[model samples]
Target chain A: MSTPVLDVQGLAFAYPDGHQALYGVNLHVHRGERVALLGPNGAGKTTLVLHLNGILDAGAGSVAVSGLPVTKDNLREIRRRVGIVFQDPDDQLFMPTVRDDVAFGPANLGIRGGELEKRVMEALDKVGMADYADRPPHHLSFGQRRRVAVATVLVMEPEILVLDEPSSNLDPASRRELAEILTGLDVTLLMVTHDLPYAFELCPRSVVLSDGVVVADGPTYDVLTDDALMAAHRLELPFGFDPRAIGRR
Target chain B: MGQGHGHKLHFHGHSPVHRAAPHHKLLALLGFTLVVVATPKDWFAAYGLYLLLLAAVVVVSTVPPTYLLKRLVVEVPFVVFALLMPFIATGPRVEVLGVSLSEHGLLAGWALLAKGTLGVLASLTLAATTEPRDLLLGLERLRLPQQLVQIMGFMIRYVDVVGDEMRRMRIARESRGFTARNPKHWPVVARSAGALFIRSYERGERVHLAMVSRGYTGSLRQGSDR
Candidate 1:
């Protein structure tokens, strides 16, 4: 890919309590590529994902999205290029109504009048939530809330989609729908997930993190199906699932 | 989250008062308060007129009298406090109901009761008709502090979240050996409260981060996109 869409080099973070969540993490994501970050809990996958949108600043190095360095001055531009869906849809959808939440991002971008309304409608349509534009977030089912959360981010028209545990609480049918939706999108995808089958089915490439460091980076099938590596790093594939056949989609 | 049991400040339904322009209803409430207070202590005719107006507005709003009366219970403390004004005040004595009471204090108490009830009913009727958001919008439009209204809007939205969280925490504590039987163990409950505060603070930080990522500048938008 000509000039990676996202570039992270030696990024590190330390909480005030002196806990190092990320340590010199370096990764590159190409334009329009769907990649998954697979690791056990506390692997710093979420910390890495937060860096993509400048939610948590990197201490050791830098993160650049769309060739723009992520910084306070350039946050608007960087955020416009990186759409992140949090692990909890409850945290993501906070507005009284779905339409307001979907409109929230576009409004922040200073999009006003009819163009903004059009953007909100188009976004709801993208996630198949047109009928629920006025429904309150709390009234929605978990699956529907997830879709509304997607709409909330999509309205910004971000180039890269970074999701943390998108399939964490979704049913099988919702997962299938999410897979289809992700597959149809031409934008870049960086998903942090512990769901092995989910990661394999949705992502072409995979990266593994363990003990605050990158342990494996390669094709999804190679990284996910390696029994020895899986055991060593606390990763596993579900019974009777073949990663090779997953790519047929 | 289920069955909508806790929302007190919500639009009752479609009604002329509910459909009235937010600005108009806001002005009317202000005017009503002004008129109600301007009336003298013994202008029973005017006081009666004001009460009639309140009833009319309540009926127009379609909010049940029971709902309004139920909420009006919030003023009982104030009413009781007003009821004490005549008894406690040292003034010209009068014999009534076999007990001497202050005549001046009684008139003052009547004024207090009249104004307070009218003021409260005006507010209750307004709240019943207009949603909290529209009321804030009305306040903003009426030149109230934008920062304050924005803060109120956010607080109204998230206060429920905070309550839900507290409820869940209380449930968890009850499940895990928490009890009020021992007054000395109250410190345990206090510690849980502190933990809840920390969790809420952390959640706020996370929410702010999410808002920044989504490009939230300062205000909450409803009508126009920006």
Candidate 2:
């Protein structure tokens, strides 16, 4: 296979208060693959994604994005290649208008003038928010703000898209819309989520992290259907969620 | 696209003032305010001219007079202060409506009222014509400190988020039968305020991380390329 779009080896991290979040975790994603990172609360999933783009420096292992190691020297390039859609849209869409928010990443990369506007427009179009370009993010609904947040990253043209809890606080319609948008994108995806149904719908593969370790990694359907594995990692499917009934269409 | 959350001052219109560049409007308003402030208190004619100028802007911008007047309520405290000056100042006395008042105090109060009202009116006109984002961009173009501009940007962006959080907390407190009807309930309010502060701080950290992940180096790019 071609070089992995993202590769993590022996990654370990702990908070300043000495609470270890990740312990020598290892993961890899190839081009155009959508992988879900599933875990119970405080299970180090967020810590792992933070390390993906050098937001959190690993205590032991190494993380490389698109063949660039996430070090101090390569952060600018790594960030350009690994776009992360944070859990909270409010945290991401800090610009005055949706257009400015979408332009932010490219502007930081020294992209200016009409080219920047074009990039902003293209990203907004991708998320179906092109008409809302001039609207302030706060004026948008939760789902609309979330779409603009994705556009904010898409303008960077990152090789890998990492999303944290993309479905939280979304209405059912918005949730499905987001899933559709994610599936339509042509980039490697690493989604960290507690929404098991979302994982089943969007991701083909799943990796379960519990207590800072990869407890299970396999096809999503297999992982979700494994009652013993789901029970062991404290990942409970919603009541009456039959994995076999939901075909991978 | 829709009514912006918590932004009530800006009146949507397609008038010349609304279409004018934000920096131009901002500078014009600043210059107009300075002129109004510098006008002699006894130059009542000049104050009238200033009022006419603002009125023309109001008409041209198509911002409703009633809407503009309502927003002027923000100047109520200053008006109160100005009103108190006429009663408190010690000066030569004058009789008006069977009440004796200081002549100097009357002039001082007039100056305060006229200048303050003009300034607020001018600002309201600018706000009604321009978007808040454009206003911040105008400040940046005016060469204000970059850090100050960014601080203002973040404040505008998250003020609603924090406000929503506060509202949710209030709902939670209310659901638990907590109400600040007296000093005895102050502790609960104080504790919630403290929690709000901590939550805001944590959100700030998370926002900073999100920025870093998206290649935020230091200064924000002023994207008025259009």
Candidate 3:
């Protein structure tokens, strides 16, 4: 009903070597909606996500965040609105300490002094990483690093929190904790993942991309249960993950 | 990633030296080193004074004496070089214990050993008191080249990541019965190094894109997140 927070239309892209990564892909994410962009490796999921914040320009079409067209002129604004949590927490939390990593985005945007400190603390607190603020990121466990990565983006106060393969390397407990943190946030979410169970658990809507195009789009449970569609896209749920039996937590 | 924080020289504590601003301590250390270097070699008492000054700092900082001794291992090569000087130089000879040695050589070696040891100890003390990140920040504040500082920052941040990758590769190699005990096994090590380089490069690209997405427009602003 509300204006979409993210709008991508006919987006197509190809690397310089002529490998087409995305082909006329279209997607829309409404305000506060959590959508999982599910696909196999090299299925252009990352390329599509890159296009969301203008990191990779649309080769043929357009991507607009909060109705602002993603272009050189609007890039700063668009980036401010779309916070991307990269796949590697090491990459995302490049700053020395957890607090600095959390403050990096907002500080780059010129937030300073008490307000900057407050944002850093609040972001760390949101991820339950306040106690680790002063610690070097390398000192933390992998799961802790991932949580700090999430806080790094959260400090920017972006409308849409885009996560890349968030559940890939986490232990079960960390995975559950991360899910709880993510679900508690009141923002639009676009998670790119190959983790079928993670997609089903976190996102109500799912868009399946295959060979650079959307092959399926609907409720996650429905898309996941469609065996032929899942097979066609090379999506496989774990042997015991039956979508029909698990109620939304 | 599996290892400890792993900064061997840095001993974390809340002593006055540890609490001092990094740039201030960096400046102080530089000034002290200059004073030591400028002191004439014949001024043995001045050297003793310098040693006493350093000892005072060490005592005040509460850095364990044994810790400093452990860190001194890094200066072993220099010590060896200095030791060679007393035997190798050609000059007027002197006999102390019936072994003839050059008087100039002896003085030169003494000066080198004293100055070098003092300098290394001062450095170790500075390192012990300051966090590595703060040291980088101190360098940036002291007008070190921005590009060099950025490179250093990236190296400090990702050294562990690269180390972890290498560990994984090594495990993967060893699990497959690749025992690198001889020269013939070097090719495998070299290949793994090459692979690590390529992986690191790709990861660099990904990190850059991640930075771009979060509005990193070239220059990095020092965050007041402390």
Candidate 4:
């Protein structure tokens, strides 16, 4: 098989206060694959996502994006390859205008002038926010702001698009709209979400993290259908929403 | 979600003043205020001319006089100070309408009111015409320190976020039947304030991490190459 776009091997980390967030964890995502990282609260989902982009250094093991290790020296290139869209769009869209926010990542790489404008517009266009390039992020609807947040990372053209709780705050229409957009994208996806239905619809495979360890890794259908496994990990589907009834996309 | 309008101070218009470059307007505001401040307090005619000039600019800018007047309530404290100047200041005495007054004090008071009013009016005009984003760009063009500029940039971007968070906190408090109507409730308010500060600090840390994830090294590279 071709090299996995994202490779995490035995990755572990503890906070400065000695709260161990992640134990030894191993995962691999190949090119153009969508994998959901499912876990309950404090299961080290955010800790693992932070490690993927060097925001948090690993205590042991390694994380590599397309064969490039995430390190101080390779941070710039690594960040370019691994784009993490935070759960709250407010945290990500910090620039004064949508155009500036979208251009921020590429501009940091020294992209300028017409090239920067083109990249910004293209990303906005992809998210159907082309008309809002000049709007302040605060003026946007919550869902629009979320889409703009996605564009901010997309402008960088990352190899692996890491989304942290992409559907947390969206209404049903916005959720469906975002799902459509995500399904159409070509990049590798690593989504950390508790939205079981979202995981079923978007990601074919799922990894269940419990007590900072990967307890289950298999098809989304298999993971969601395992009643005992779901019960043990506190991973519950919305009441009466059956994965078998909906089936795989 | 309803708070999507641009800055409240800004009035949308296509007047020539609005079309003028922000840096140019900033410099003009500075020049006008300095000239007003430097003029002798006794030069009542010069002050009137300055007012006329400002009034003309206001007319050109197309911002309503009532809009400017309503916001001028911010100047009430200064007005009180100016009004008290004549009564408290020691100077040569004079009688006007059978009331004792100091001649120099009257002039000083007049000067204070005139200068303060002119400065406030001019600033309002500038703010009413230029968008907040453009004002930041104008400051950048004026060679303001990049760090300060970035601070203001972040403040503009996150002010709404902080405000929304505060609103939610207030709603949560109200839902729990908490209200600070007197000094007895001070501690609750203070604790809420403390919580907000900590939350904002944590948010700052998260924002920094987000910046780092996007390749922000130390200083922002925006406008450096442009």
Candidate 5:
């Protein structure tokens, strides 16, 4: 109601080869709210996420973060506000040591010396990866690397934390741990996921994107319970995993 | 992928050499190699002294002699070239052990072996003591171009990722009962290589996007991020 943290209005995008990824789409996420962007493969989920950070310019509409439009001039401030945790941890953690990787974003902002160190450690501490500050990312376990990836973004203190497939390769325990971490965070969250159970547990609100359009936007419980909508959009819950039986957390 | 402590060439140690600043060691390595290269080939005594100096450093560095010796296998091709120098090189002849050999050729061959061995040994000692990251930082401190440093940093970071991807591709190929047993299978291997290149290129683009999303402009700031 009072200036949503992320405002996407009529956002649309198409690849260079004439493949239209997103049609006109409108969504708004308020401060401190967690929202899941749910869609099947090629439903323009990634296209929408890219737009949020100005990685891909909008074909038709505009995306603004916390009232600041994502444009060339506002890119630095916009990037600072919108932190995207990519699906593959390997893609995000590109520095030699965990400390360096975590410090990369802040360092880019000209943060130096003790301030940078403190920020890096604080982020690592939040993810319980404080001990691995000096360790090479390649030496870390897959889940640990994922946690480190989150720290790399968290160090920036973004307003809206955009996670792309956060639970894709995580084991059950890792998934639960990440959920705990994500739930504890105090930032607006936009999770792009096909993990229905995860969405039900983490995000209070869910938006279903089908054919580059928002087909459904409602409470997570309502979205998951709509059998016809789920069937039509190819959104399937795991066998015997009933949302009504377990209910929302 | 499960490399625990240090890089393959690095021996985890806490000796004075390991504690020494990386750029200093880099300069020392350069100085030592230059001195060795500049010495006259006939100066056999000077060569021995250089070896002694290298041996002392190796001892001080606490890297085992056998470790250095084991890695010297990389110089085998050079060693073979040095060994053939006396036979093919034309020079004044001298008989030793009933075999005639060119005197200049023998000296040239000796110099090549001595210089090559000393250089290789010194480099191995440096590598054995210093971590790869430290060495790169040392290069940065030595005023290497920032872009080149960043490229090297990224290469070090993603080499394993690319390697793992290749390994997975190989496994996928093997699972499908494909093997490059002969020249007939070269095309398959070439195609796989092409696929890897394209995948790596796409990954590079994604990594660039990720960097952009995190506020990376044209150049990374020179700070503690190194």
Candidate 6:
């Protein structure tokens, strides 16, 4: 695999109120590898994701996206290389119009003129939202709005796309569409999700977190099949539904 | 989830007024109001002509006359104020229907009505023709502060979401044995409002974090898919 695009070492973070979220988490993502971070609530999945993109400052240790360290000075460059999608589509899709929301990141990055406009269209097209450019965010369905949120980040064309619960609230069709879209993208992905089937489908590697620590990381099939570890972390497969059999072609 | 996206109640149609640029519409509307406001008490002819101009615009735009009049009823609460104006002032008596009333007061009431109607029509036409996004853009072009525009843009985008959330909260409270009949339940209503505010604040923080991950700096911009 290409040299690790994202490098992290012993990352830790605590809210000012003293609630520790991430506990010395050590993880890395290589180019073109789709990795899933699976854990129950309060597992610090979002906190770790925020650190990857430098959204929140780490209390300890280090994080680097595409070799750029997450810091005040390198934040802009790090952000450009790592696009993170929040769990809630409502939170992400905040512009008056879909076109505006998608163009927001690119425009902020200083892209302008015909080139900027082209990027905006291409980004919307990436998420199958070309026809929704004129529609306001509030006017779209939940599934459609979720796709627009993805487009908003895709416009940046980051090297590593980090998603917090991409499939969380989506319906079956939307979930399938999300899987299809994520699978087709040729970039590094570190998605934080609790859906075992979704993780098995999109990612070949699975990383388990519990109490803010990475307890297990390995091939998706092997890690998911470990029932003892899954039980400890509250991860489970639905009745009679198997991940390995359904995940692969 | 309004599948029937009752697409905001704007008076939209293919009329000269509707087709005009939002910038021009805003200017014309504001100027018309300013003229009415600045007019002398006896300047009813100018005010009448301006009202006529507004009516002509309304006809040019295909917005339902009833809808236009209905929206104009926001001034209903001011009826008492208007009624008292003529009698409160000391001026030449203008008694027609066997009642003493100030002529100045009558002129003032007419001027207020004419100006208010004209202003509302101008805004209605602008809103009917141009979407909110376009209106914000027009404002930006007019050199309104960027911060103000950004705030307004987000407000417009999320108002419906927040409104829906509020509605759901009310429903939830009602389902749990709360009702408007109890005077003692006022605190519960206030608490819900406070809770809603907290939820909104947290939601804003999460949303901001999401934006930063997607490469947002402080600047806000929209795509040109159109």
Ranking by lDDT: 4, 5, 2, 3, 1, 6
In model 3, where do residues sit more than 4 Å from their true spots?
A247-249, B91-104, B223-226
C-alpha RMSD of candidate 4: 1.9
Q: What is the TM-score of chain A in candidate 5?
A: 0.98
lDDT of 4 at B216: 91
True contacts kept of 6: 0.75
Give the Cα-based TM-score of candidate 2 against the true structure.
Answer: 0.93
Ranking by DockQ: 4, 3, 2, 5, 6, 1
Residues A113-137 of candidate 6: C-alpha lDDT, one tens digit per residue: 7887799899888888899887878
Candidate 1: where is the Cα deviation over 4 Å? A171-173, A236-249, B3-6, B34-40, B93-96, B99-105, B177-189
Docking category of candidate 5: medium
User: What TM-score does chain B of candidate 1 reach?
Assistant: 0.84
Tell me the DockQ of each model, to 2 decimals: 0.45, 0.59, 0.61, 0.67, 0.59, 0.58
lDDT of 3: 0.89
Q: Candidate 4 lDDT, tens digit per residue, B48-145?
A: 89989989988998899999999988899989988887788886889889988888778888899999999999999999999877888888889989
| Candidate 3 lDDT for residue A142 | 87
The residue pairs in collision within model 5 are none
On DockQ, who's better, 4 or 5?
4
Determine the iRMS, in angstroms, of model 2: 2.8
What class would a CAPRI assessor give candidate 1's docking?
A: acceptable
Error of 6 at B3 (Å): 6.4
Give the per-residue lDDT digits (tens) of candidate 4, residues A1-249: 988899999999989999999899999999999999999998999999999999889999999999999888999999999999999888888887788889889988889888988998999989999999888888898999999999999999999999999999899999999999999898899999999999999999999999999999999999999999999999999988998898766
* Model 5 lDDT per residue over A157-199, tens place: 9999999999998889999999999998888899999999999
Regions of candidate 6 where Cα sits further than 4 Å from its true position: A244-249, B3-7, B84-111, B181-184, B221-226
Q: Is the docking of candidate 2 incorrect, acceptable, medium or high quality?
A: medium
Comparing 3 and 4 on lDDT, the stronger one = 4
B-chain TM-scores per prediction: 0.84, 0.92, 0.87, 0.89, 0.87, 0.84
Higher-scoring candidate on lDDT, 3 or 6: 3
Tens digits of per-residue lDDT, candidate 2, B55-151, equal 9889988899999998999999989988888789997898989988888888999999999999998998898888877888899999999999899
Which candidate number maximizes TM-score? 4
Query: Which residue runs of candidate 5 sit more than 4 Å off their true CA positions?
Result: B1-5, B91-105, B221-226
